[model samples]
Every structure is written in structure tokens, then in C-alpha cells.
Target: MVEHQRRPGWAEVEDFLSATLVQGGTEMAAVIESIDAAGMPRIEVAPTAGKLLMLLVRIQGARRVLEIGTLAGFSTIWLARGMPDGGHVTTCEYLPEHAAVARRNLDVAGVGSMVDIRVGAALDTLPTLLGGEPYDFVFIDADKSNNVNYLKWALKLTRPGSVIVMDNVIWEGTILDPDADPDAGAIRAALEFMGASPLLDATAIQTAGSKGWDGFAIAVVRQGSATLGE
Candidate 1:
């Protein structure tokens, strides 16, 4: 068996390809360009991932979605667009500035009403939000150190068969090393948790293209007897 050699900056390359493929689409392309102009941390999920997310939401017929990060609302727009007519996505951002920009982007995308931009630490906000109701899908793409915490919260609030997509799971090849960096350690822990969790059926895919050196882990909450999209 060949060793699983971790690629470098694969996630970034994937994002670039996503932007490239989605280019020329009037509204989505414009949003991608604006995000590029901002020069913010290039942590947003790739457009292909966004499309996959939308498809997952639509496949589950998700009416309520939760996103842990809302950077520029790029990924949020994709999620919102996938919603069945009245579906809504509640996304959280720790930085006020980022949240504000995301709000604006969502507004520009005409998905403001469907996408709620919450400004605060997702850790603090997730508990409170969970009290109200559960979400049909949850996407995690925030501080890598808190990924495990985010997954814990997501597991509690999502119903059976709900999809939970975690970005940057490979962490620029850091995760493959036995001696882990802080962020890599955290990502490893989350991956381990998902691997062992009885309630989740998870898989990680290695993607290569524009966004470089990374991959994502997608876990589906398993519902016994009852099928998804009931």
C-alpha cells in the first residue's frame, strides 16, 4: 500500500480553481472578485466545495442550515442559494468587520434575508443557537484550534443524516506529521473524533487544482432505518 503523502497548499489551489470555474457567472463571479480585492485571509472554501455543499443541502432538502464561519459570505451565498424556497442559513463570524462585509455580500447576492450573519465567537453562540432548534446541515470553517469544539456542537444540533462539512482538514500537510503543530493537532483530534463517532459516517477526499495543499472531511449523521430527506 502506498503511503498517504500529504500535499502542500492543495486547499488554496482548489479555491482558485473554484473561482476560475465560477468565473463569468455574473453575480457569483462578481462576489468572488470582491473577495479577492479585499485581501482577507484566503480561507474561504473553494467554489467546487460550495457547489457540493449546495447539492448536499438540496439533496437533504435542508430548510435550516448552520455555518460556523461566514467570511465575506462567499460560501454562505452558495448555501443560501441551495435552500428550498424558504430555507435559511445562519452563519457566524467572530470578527465584526468580516461579519459586516459578509452581510453586505449576502445582501448584494439577494440572499440577505435567507442568510443570517451572527457576529460573535461561534463557541459561545453555538450553545445558545442550539436551544432554539436543530439545523439540517452544518459547515465548519473557522479557527482550526476550535474545530473539535465546533464538531461537538454540530453533532448535538444536527438531526440524523444531516451533513457536516469541515474545511481544511489536511491543514497544508501538517496533519500527516506525527509531531503535530497546534492547528494540526486540533484538526487531527477532530478527524479522530469523527472517525470513531458512532453517529457519524465520515470520509475525507483529497482534491487538487487551484486551491493548494489541503482537503475537506464530510460527515453524514447516520439515521438507522429512516432514510435521509424524509
Candidate 2:
């Protein structure tokens, strides 16, 4: 296990900044506690990242959103909370138990009504999600092996001004090493895909906090590139 020494530098700064800027309500706190009680994997975005998602949604005036992962609904609640009234969030979860816990957690947070939980492998469920109104924002936090494909679906289901966010791409900087793990290779491949794709203007930001070192790839859709429109 990684040692939990008190980080006196950037990570500590992040924790302080998060506490100063992002305030979680009682319901939101319960959501986190419930996730722990249920013994779910602790892979959800950090509080700062969750706040960032909310801020991005509010900045973009996004009325509809798609999330590729729904682990205990932490990020899902954040996204839903950031939207205006009548806004909706669609989240995909492959594991039934995780989805069930997420559903309960979302309800406890009072954002369940704003979310549509799609239970299935995202690669399969994504294709069935066609013909709906395109999302104004898409967050890809699912399996990294299919990161490129997720971007393709995000593009297909978004229009100009839409934003795409991919999580955990940096993997503590392992992606830079040629002999890294498969997920690291996949992250590099996704970066290459973003570089070559004409439909998106993409960039990434490194992040650190309680979740350790990682980063997200963010993209904005190009005009007239979406094959389908809302």
C-alpha cells in the first residue's frame, strides 16, 4: 500500500483550496459516507474535481450531460447539482451492484431525479443511446482501454460548444513511460486520437489531491462536426 505520509506541498495546498472553495451539503456528505459503508471502490473523483465538473457545467450552460461512469454517483450528483432546473444527467454503470448503490446514493443526495442510470457495458449501451437529444457535456470516466471509442461517441452525441472530459488519463505520469501498463498505453493512444481528430479541440490538465496524481483530457466540439444534433 502507498504510504499516507502528510503531503506538505501541492497535495496539501489542494486540500486547503478545496475546503475553501467547495462546500458540501449534509446530503452530499451522506452520499460519501454511504459509499464507504457500502464498500465500493474508492475511485470517484476528488472533491475538487467534482466541483470542477459542476463549474464547467454551469459555465457551459449545459442542460443535458452524459457520464461514462457512475461509481456510487459521487460525480453524477456533482454534475446534476451544477445544472439548471430541468437539466438531466445520463450515467452509465456496468456493474449492477455499483449501479444499485449509485441509485441509492443519488437519491440520498436528492439528485436521483436528475439522473438516468444506464446499466450495461458502456460500449454496448452507448450505441443504444442514439436518436436522443445531444448532450451539452460528456464526462468519460470509464475503462481506459476504450477511451478513444468513448470520445467518438461523445462527438457523435454532441454539437458545437459541447465539452468532453476524460478522467485519470495521466495515471501519476505513468503514461509517459513506454513500458507502462496497458491502461497507460491506452491513455497515450487516446491522446493521439485527440491530436488527430478534426472534430475536437483538446487539452489536458494535471491534477492532484486526495485522489493522488492524475489528469483529465478536456475537449470542445468543432462546429459542424457532430453527425447527430439535438
Best by lDDT: 2
Candidate 2, position 19, lDDT? 71
For residues 1-230, what per-residue lDDT tens digits would candidate 1 score against the true structure?
99997765755665576667654256677666777777777667767877888888888789999999898888898898889888989998999988877887888888898987788899888877755667989989999889878888887788887899998888678887736588888899899989988878999987665566678999988886232221
lDDT of each: 0.81, 0.88
The clash count of every prediction, one per candidate, is: 18, 0
Tell me the deviation in Å of residue 36 in model 2.
Answer: 1.8
Lowest summed lDDT over 10 consecutive residues: which window, candidate 2?
221-230
Model 2, stretches more than 4 Å misplaced?
A: 1-7, 228-230
The runs of at least 3 residues in candidate 1 whose Cα sits more than 4 Å from the true structure, single-residue gaps closed, are: 1-24, 178-180, 224-230
Estimate the overall C-alpha local distance difference test score of candidate 1: 0.81
